[model samples]
Target: MLHLMIAIPAFARMYNVSCKMCHVAFPKLNGFGQAFADNGYVFAGKQGEIYRNLGDDRARTFKELPLAVRFTHYVAASYDGGKAMTDFQSPWSVKFLLGGAPNERINFYAYVIFEKGLPPFFEDAWIDLHGFFGLPFSLTLGQFQISDLMFMRETRLTRSDFYIYKVGPYKITYHRGALLGTPIGDFGVVNGNGLSALNGKYYDDNPSKWFFGHLPLPADFGLFGLWGEDYDTLGNYVRLYRLGLDWRGVFESFYPFFQILVGFDNDTSNLFYGGFFGVDYAPGGDGVVSLLFNYVDAPANSPYRNERLATLALRYSHYVLTNLKVFAEGEGWLFKRSLALTLGVDFAF
Candidate 1:
């Protein structure tokens, strides 16, 4: 399943506002949406503070559970190498999503998956506390993607992925960690082992950790670095470093974004580099068209060798309602010499 993230409809229900207040579409955030997130999942001032606690003085609770569901269902057809295939992949992913202010200073976000496996799993479960100790900083602790600080796919408008974040040679996306940051910048240290660490009771057999620092630059640009010194499963000594730069711009109805990263590993003698460029164009009413291209260049020792790897995708999404969108995308996976077309629906409510 290709994971999908959303600006949950719960906010719309709680604030009594239209979904468009934060989203240009179901998952694509507008400028106001970025501000809402920066302000602890609420509107500026006291508008988002209108909720009344259902609990007593000592505890604050919601009058209604602030929860929503997001899912994807798709039909994919592709020709890879010499093989051609077509299939129905309905319910590609189903998520129980929730996020909101638990109190004045704390906003939390999480999503649990219900795919093929029983006893569903959590993809994101983090609490963000603003103005900690009455200072200018914030704190976040839980499981999340470090890549978000560099180039967040959660708010992107494409059905395809930002492949750089998933590249094996410089991988640094998922884990459990504590982050100290503000809107301008953040620093974090997470278990260097990825999701495996979270599944293993957040335990680490090695003492090393992954360290990351991100700073926002002027003009909607950002820079970040990730460092890791750890041992591989086979006990091979490893030291990895990554540097990324991201930028985004909006011209009326068109929004364009670009992100690139360079990574090196001393132990494996591997060097990796890649980036993705995408643009979203909303000409008018209820519809969005997006184009994305991701490319990677890896050393010969890496899985993707020779720099002959890339993916190009074009997608169109139409909102039938605020919480439901139907989309179709045509993609070329240059790495596998495959071409695909997928018809899908995304629902968030």
Candidate 2:
């Protein structure tokens, strides 16, 4: 899903602005885009009172019921074992999104989706309230991603993934709990569990830590170190910790980023360390090219079994319109001698 997006069109329609106002590319938040989101989806200068309905004193109202839809279709090919296989996974997914800000202080967003090979369900429904008890930080009391504090998967540039999230040690999905985000840093607690058949409501976050999970600095560098007690595959609760460093930079049309982590699982003294580096380049007003390289290694007895992965991916996206995009991608595994290719279309309105 993100390092996923708002190509929802509703935001542009609501604010009477162009999509580019918030995105360097569709789904990728620009500086102003990040600001708009940080402001609880409201304009920074004012509360946007003139844009709201007048009938609400007890509850907030929207000038319009903000809504949008996103659809993805793709054709792909990949090397499996020693042969090439074709995949016609068109209409990969369809998503219905609803998001709105009633005022400057509160905002909400969620989505329902029907994905291929998956049950239709709703996900990522959360409300964000700005300024907690007159504090400078915001409190998000709902579901979000812990990895979001670092490299957000839903808002990424490539169809491939980061080493830390995909197969390394972490997971990419929804976590239910609360988060406090400030200008310089952010800290939060989450269920420490992935979504399941019951929506994982029976689970809860371990809240005893802060400066604990993910930390990114304004200097284009980041540090992460956190510990948690959770169950292993054997259904026994165990202690685990992850530590890492990351950095990124931008130079005109080029942007590059990197992340590395070392983790110990289930009280194992042996550790696994790895990371990924990637770049995004905008060579034209409506097109972006992206490249990624990832590698990770783990101990033999560790859950990761000292597994190693080395892959490279490249992608190019062209904006057919502000809310529509077409893309193609190619990926190769260095050790496995495998390759994958995809041509896809992603559109929203």
Candidate 3:
């Protein structure tokens, strides 16, 4: 399993507030945090005071650069074949998060990730344009995780589960053009011009591209759409177009949410659809219990054609110091029939 971490302390510094103000735990955003994000990372309270030169007619400047670092490590033991293998290893995933509003209307978020045995890469780079064209919508541009529009997989503490957001249809390659001098009726066996009649040009394939927008409606409801192209393990290319609707609200201390996404794979003419309904019960402070159900359906020719996932997780966290946190969580996946117990710590400075 890939160990991914997401914790941003820059928001705390930007808002001059405790991490609890926006997060139920280390990375899960609370109601206030969601609002802050919706506003493009501009704090509703004491905004101008957090930064310098708010009245400047020139480029916006920060009193101090908003940057934060996070490190996470865990130890685990798994059971297999009536035996247990215990290992003490460091996931050793580190993240450098940087972003904040240059001004009230514009906000940006970016992350540089370094992981064990992997070269560093820029992940989740995006700029948020709040209230686009004086409408109740926001425009986000850059490479981002489309799953975030529905369920926030980053916020979940499960290490042994696969959710619908992580599953999709298989890729299908398109024959753009036949190889030169190849028979028009023959769609097989020719390799020249770097374009094979059997297999189209695989070289110089670009990475996936994405564009999405979000609109906030009344009653804590939101709608979004995403369009992009992705490649599968077989090197087949697929185009993804998705539309989603979500509703979230807090009642007392419980946060209830529902999300549905309808996606289409244009290349293969397949349907990719899913829904996630869950509730986070945050009694208070830094402890949260989550129950979520996820269901996805894809075309028969696609991988993960009829996969369904459900997860139940319990988490507790405590601050050892102002910038250090200790947490332990246990989660189980119903379909995968797996359980994971994790004891980890997070520190930010």
Error of 1 at 268 (Å): 8.9
Please rank every candidate by TM-score, starting with the best: 1, 2, 3
Evaluate residue 134 in candidate 3 and report its C-alpha lDDT on the 0 to 100 scale.
62
Tens digit per residue, CA lDDT, model 2, 58-133: 6666677788888989899999688989998978999888987766667788888899869887767778777657
Judged by lDDT, which candidate is best? 1
Across 99-146, the per-residue lDDT of candidate 3 in tens digits comes to 888877677777788887587877666665655466554445443554
Score each candidate by Cα lDDT.
0.79, 0.72, 0.59
User: Stretches of candidate 1 above 4 Å error?
Assistant: 1-6, 45-50, 53-57, 116-119, 197-202, 301-308
| Candidate 2: regions farther than 4 A off | 1-7, 45-50, 55-58, 168-173, 199-211, 268-270
Q: Which of the predicted structures, 1 or 2, would earn the higher TM-score when compared with the native? A: 1
- Give residue 208's lDDT in candidate 3 (0 to 100): 49
Q: Name the runs in model 3 displaced over 4 angstroms.
A: 1-7, 52-56, 81-83, 130-137, 157-162, 169-245, 260-275, 293-302, 305-311, 319-323
How good is model 1 by TM-score? 0.91
The number of the candidate with the highest TM-score is: 1
Query: In candidate 3, where is summed lDDT lowest over 10 consecutive residues?
Result: 178-187
TM-score of each: 0.91, 0.89, 0.70
User: Would you give me the overall lDDT of model 2?
Assistant: 0.72
How far does residue 106 in candidate 2 sit from its true spot (Å)?
1.4
